[model samples]
Target: MEILDWIQDWFKDNCDGNWEHGEVIQITTLDNPGWEVEIDISNTSIATMNLAWIRNDNGKEDWYGVKIENQKFTAAGDAGKLKFLLGLFKEMIDKIEA
Candidate 1:
């Protein structure tokens, strides 16, 4: 719940009127029974980050991946990983801030 609150706050923080019109964030379900998150860093604080993708595939259902493409931060994981992937994004942001 805390992470979700933080994510809402982060979204609010980035809502500069203009950025909000671009559909900067998207959370969708994948047909493969999973979640997908795409956040457009655009002119935000993390836009300049050059972080590499993160992937973990321990087994069939225990798999996830994250990466920055163009100007968007993208991630996907199994059905139960929605919050976990968000947490990973938070960790990346925290790491940058730290």
Candidate 2:
């Protein structure tokens, strides 16, 4: 999964192994045939945070809803926050390429 790889690389680059013991758990799929992803960052001292992604059942196939600490923050079409989380890694990858 590209997201997994990107997350791992992000930790390696930005977190200084703080997330070395982190895990990405695949939670149950909803009836909408959407995926649920759980990201654990408890190993880091920064904060005991857990993030989640719920694939939207609507026609917006590329969109996802985001949750932090089980609290819904962003709707499917509003991916800015999600991208910010993913962008932490994407920025590093971009630097490497630059």
Candidate 3:
């Protein structure tokens, strides 16, 4: 699966049964062959924002930043190095909400 597909799947799995309102808003791919996927779930009671970072085999690492204000959460991760960014994301969200 492509990076975007993987990210979408991840989000779907983690959306906490809030899938229809949450959506992938924008996707931007970099020249470094890295990619960014943005998800907007603002329509819900809580505003949700997600960014995905993608990097290839090179030493460089990309970043994805996700923000959720209404529900209280923030997220980011290095795509090239981490297995899955969910841990980082949850931590970030907890910090923001806390």
Counting clashing residue pairs in each candidate, in order, gives: 0, 0, 0
For model 2, the stretches where C-alpha displacement exceeds 4 angstroms are 8-24, 45-63, 70-98
Q: Pick out the ten consecutive residues of candidate 3 with the lowest summed lDDT.
A: 50-59
TM-score of 2: 0.37
Worst 10 residues of 2 by lDDT: 71-80
Better of 1 and 3 by TM-score: 1
**Best-matching candidate per TM-score:** 1
Give the RMSD in angstroms, all C-alphas superposed, for model 1: 1.4
Give the Cα lDDT of each candidate.
Answer: 0.86, 0.44, 0.45
Which residue pairs does candidate 3 place in steric collision?
Answer: none
Residue 62 displacement (Å), model 2: 6.1
The best candidate in terms of lDDT:
1
What TM-score fits each model?
0.90, 0.37, 0.32
